[model samples]
Target: MSDPILRLEGIHTDIAQYHILHGVDLEVPRGAVTMLLGRNGVGKTTTLRTVIGHWQARAGRILFDGAEITGAKTPDRARMGIGYVPEDMGIFSDLTVEENMTLAAATGPLDPARRDRIFEAFPPLRTFWRSPAGTLSGGQKQMLTIARAMAEERRLYLIDEPTKGLAPAIVSTMAGALRDLKRQGASILLVEQNFAVAKALGDYAAVMDDGRIVWAGEMQELATDAGLQERLMGLSMEAQ
Candidate 1:
């Protein structure tokens, strides 16, 4: 296999006086979706923030495509081809969907081909092109945020809990969009708690506990092993 597109080695982060992430080691292989799985408050989100420079790493190194980016600024990281969608789905409430997408383009105008691809992935984006982002439903807002990240080409995407609080139908739509991205060979580091979504989209899975990775394996293996799921994520059969 090729070298991972994103790697975190012994990463530690602190929020105020509290230590949130303790020595996290993770890898997201090229062209694969690596699921960062854990219960709430286990530092999964902190790890993503550290990677994208929203939270500085107190220690350890972050590598993107073999270059050390531990000290890189957030904009530098984004310029280096890291796309991020935070848990809050950072959309401009007053802006139209088109305006929000235009702002996300790294270079000049959005590439026509990329715009078509994004529309294909989330057709609602096309339907609500001129609508205020705030006027859209929760699911449409989520789609807009994801589409904004895809407005231009990106080497890696750091997405946090995208399906949170959405209806099952919307979750399925989001999952299908991610699946299309996977087919298009996009590399993603996804932090998700919904086991169903994880099982649907993860190529590899890493389970975190108290700021440390406790298990790493194939997604299918983790999905089928209910006992392991129960122990690692406190998941019940129904949850799976």
Candidate 2:
């Protein structure tokens, strides 16, 4: 396989007085989606934050595109081609959808080709082009968040719990959008709870528990092995 686009080695993090991530090691290969799966409070979000510098790593190295980025600021990481979509769907509530997209295109004005691609991936973005982001439904806002990340060319995407609280139809839409991204050769490190969505988009999978990775392998392997899934994640395909 080609070298990973992103790698985390012995990553440690703390939030307030509590240690969140402990010696977390992960690899996201180029041109594929790597699902970060775990029960809540296992430090999946913290791992993403540490990658983008939202939470500083207390120890260890973060290499992106073959260079160490452990000390890089969040904006520097963004400039280094890492796009992030936090779980909250970080859209500007008071701004128009167009404006939100424009802001996400940090390099310059929104490129027409990029805009076309984003709109094609999430059709609601076009329909609500001029509407305030707050006016959009939960699914539309989620689309906007992912679209904003796609506003510019990015080598890697760090997405957290994108399917949380969405209707099944919306989850299906989100799944399609991720598939579109994967087809375009975008590498993604996705933190997700919905096993069905994970099964659909993940090319590889990692299971975290108590802030450490306990299992790493092909997504299909985990999907088919009910005993493995039950042991690592406490859920089988039927439960999911």
Candidate 3:
């Protein structure tokens, strides 16, 4: 990992009575995708939320680009060039696709050239420009959420399960978009269950269990070693 762009040290977070993250320590390498892998209810989503300030950490620190941001508000974090694509696909359902895209461009209207390029990648967005976001299919809604984040250039993106609950074709499309995002030199902390996507996009991999990171290393190392995979995630990537 060449100088992590984001670091979480001893991060503890709780949602009411349920303690979700129990001291997560993880690092996202600069200009690379760091895959966050774990089973259900293991705090993968919570860790990403903590970094983005959606669910504040009860203890420990979160540093983004070398500045401690544990106490920063979500809007402030967003203004500081941190983008988040939530698991639920956070987009205004009532807003038109064009309207949703326009609102997320914090620096006023989006640049025309970049917008054109985004449209090229996700052509449905262009086709449904005037349609309400609520009318989009599940895959199209996912695309809208990712496109909303890409409406402007950000230093880092915290994406949670971008390929969840989609057909194989749509999953492949999502993977390609993420690959393109990586090609553009963007740092991504991705929480993915699909091992194939994780192995394909990740440069570094971190595995979490019981709200803490149990393993951290190169994705290739984890992908190839079935024993290590079983110990950390309780299943082989080959089987999944």
Candidate 4:
């Protein structure tokens, strides 16, 4: 197999003396979708933030496309083809959908072909192209956020909970968009809490507990191993 597009080894992070990520290790292979699963506060978001250089890691190393990026600045990483969409979706309420996308395109030249491809994958965004991002529904804003990242033509995309707080219908739509991105040969590192959604879209899955990965394997294997899911992800049918 080719070297991974992104990898984190022994990543330890501190948020003003409060340790968050504890020796977290993960990888997103080139052109594949990797899911990071964990309960709330288990460092999944922190891991993505650290990888994007928002929260500097106190220890360990992060590599992107075979170059060490542990110390890379946030803007430097963005220029190196890493795009991040946080749980809040990160869309500017004051900006129109098109404006938000144009801002993200600042990272790289916008390819008309790719822009059309993104629109083809997410027709809703095209419909709301002139509307303010804040005026859109939760799902529409989420699509715009991910679409903005796509506009950058980045090699890897880190998305935190793209499906959170949306209707089931919209979640399924976003899932299809993710599949389109995968088909376009873009690598994705998804931090998602919905087990069903994660298992549906991710090729590989890692379960994190207490800031440490407790299990990592093919998505099918993780989905089938109910015992491991319960132990690592705190999943239960009764709760669902």
Candidate 5:
């Protein structure tokens, strides 16, 4: 396998006197979806924030494509190819779909190509291209968030709770969109509690508990290993 596109070694994050992430270690391989699975408040979102430079890590190393990005500014990291889609979805309420996409467009000749690709992944975005962002449903908003991230050039992407509050059908649509991005070679670090969605989309899975990754392996292994699921994720057959 190739070297990881994103790697964190002993990453520790502190948010205003609160130690949220404690020596977290994980890797997002190039062109693959790496899912971070955990119950709520286990530092899953913090890890992504720290990676995107929203929350600074007081200790540890973050290397992206072999370059240390631990201290790089968020914009610098984005320019260097790391796109982040937060849980909030970051949609401008008043902005139209087309405006939102245009605002996030990467700096280069790839703008048109990116737009076309986003349209391909999200046909709904194209159909609602003239609609206000706030008028869209939860799923469409999530799609817009992802499409915005794809506007920038990136080797790795950090997405948080993308399927948080949507209908089952919309959740399936979101999953399909993620798969399309993966097919286009986007390395993704996903923070998701939706096990079914994660199982369907992830290539690798890491289970986090109390700010530390307790287990990491292939998604298939995680899917079949009921023992690990129960012990680490607190998931059971009944839950499934």
Candidate 6:
């Protein structure tokens, strides 16, 4: 791969006593989407968290753009133009939809043009503009989290399972929004379970098993070869 926006070399991460990631070497090409595919509980989320500095890596080098961010604090990582959309859909339930977006603005008031763009990408956020975040459905909440991350211009985004349990229509909407983000030149490292969606959006793909990257190549190659898909992703993974 060319010079990537984000790179992890020999990453090892432990959550308390349980070891999760073992030597996770990966790269997210600039201005493109890289799908991290794996079965349930195979350290996909752990990898994204490690990149965002949510969980400190036991050992490894994490480079964002060109600088080492292996030891940077989570807040510092956020400040340095990295946006994270976790699996949990981090949001303030008590806050209104508008409030949540305003908070994500961070530096100052939300920009008018950016807010409009977010609303265009996710119309539900506009519908529930003044409603508390808790009032929205699961898909809407997912949209909100993604919208929050898109509220500002970031160099890269770390998104985990944006379509986990969403309706097909909502999933389509989410996919379109992600495509727009790619068009806008934001590098995204996405952990997605829906292989169809992954194939549609990804330029490159990495398959993880037992905390290590087992397969990596262009998404087109993985999409076209069923044998490779079965060999790398397996029936166990697709069943999930």
Candidate 1 C-alpha error for residue 17, in Å: 0.8
Give the deviation of candidate 6 from the true structure as CA RMSD. 1.4
Ranking by TM-score: 2, 3, 6, 1, 5, 4
TM-score of 3: 0.97
Q: Taking the tens digit of each residue's C-alpha lDDT, what string does model 5 give over 1-240?
A: 469898899999999989999999998888999999888999999999999999899999999999999999999999988999999888897999988887887574437777887888788999999999999988889999988998876788899999987889878878887888888788999988788888889899888899998998898898877887888877662265
- The lDDT leader among the candidates is 6
Q: Clashes per prediction?
A: 0, 0, 0, 0, 0, 0
Q: What is the TM-score of each candidate against the true structure?
A: 0.96, 0.98, 0.97, 0.94, 0.95, 0.97
Estimate every model's Cα lDDT from 0 to 1. 0.90, 0.92, 0.92, 0.86, 0.87, 0.93
TM-score comparison, 3 vs 5, better candidate: 3
Better of 2 and 6 by lDDT: 6
Candidate RMSDs in Å, in order, are 1.2, 1.0, 1.0, 1.7, 1.6, 1.4
List the candidate 3 regions with Cα displacement exceeding 4 Å. none
Poorly placed runs, candidate 2 (over 4 Å): none
Winner by TM-score between candidate 5 and candidate 1: 1
Instruction: List candidate 6 stretches off by more than 4 Å.
Output: 236-240
Worst 10 residues of 1 by lDDT: 231-240
Q: For candidate 4, write residues 1-240 as lDDT tens digits.
A: 458898889999999978988899887889989999878898989999999999999999999999999999999999998989999877899998888888888845667887788888788888988888899987888888889888866789999999989899989889998998888788999988787898789898888888888888888887777776777666752244
lDDT of 6 by residue, 1-240 (tens): 779999999999999999999999998899999999988989999999999998999898999999999999998999899999999998999999999999999989999999999989999999999999999999999999999998888989999999999999999999999999999989999999998899899999999999999998899888888878888877633333
Q: Write the per-residue lDDT of candidate 3 for residues 166-192, one digit (tens) a residue.
A: 988988888888888889999999999
Q: What are the per-residue Cα lDDT tens digits for candidate 2 across 110-200? A: 9999899888888888999999999999989999999999998888999999999999998988899888888888899999888888998
Candidate numbers sorted by lDDT from highest down: 6, 2, 3, 1, 5, 4
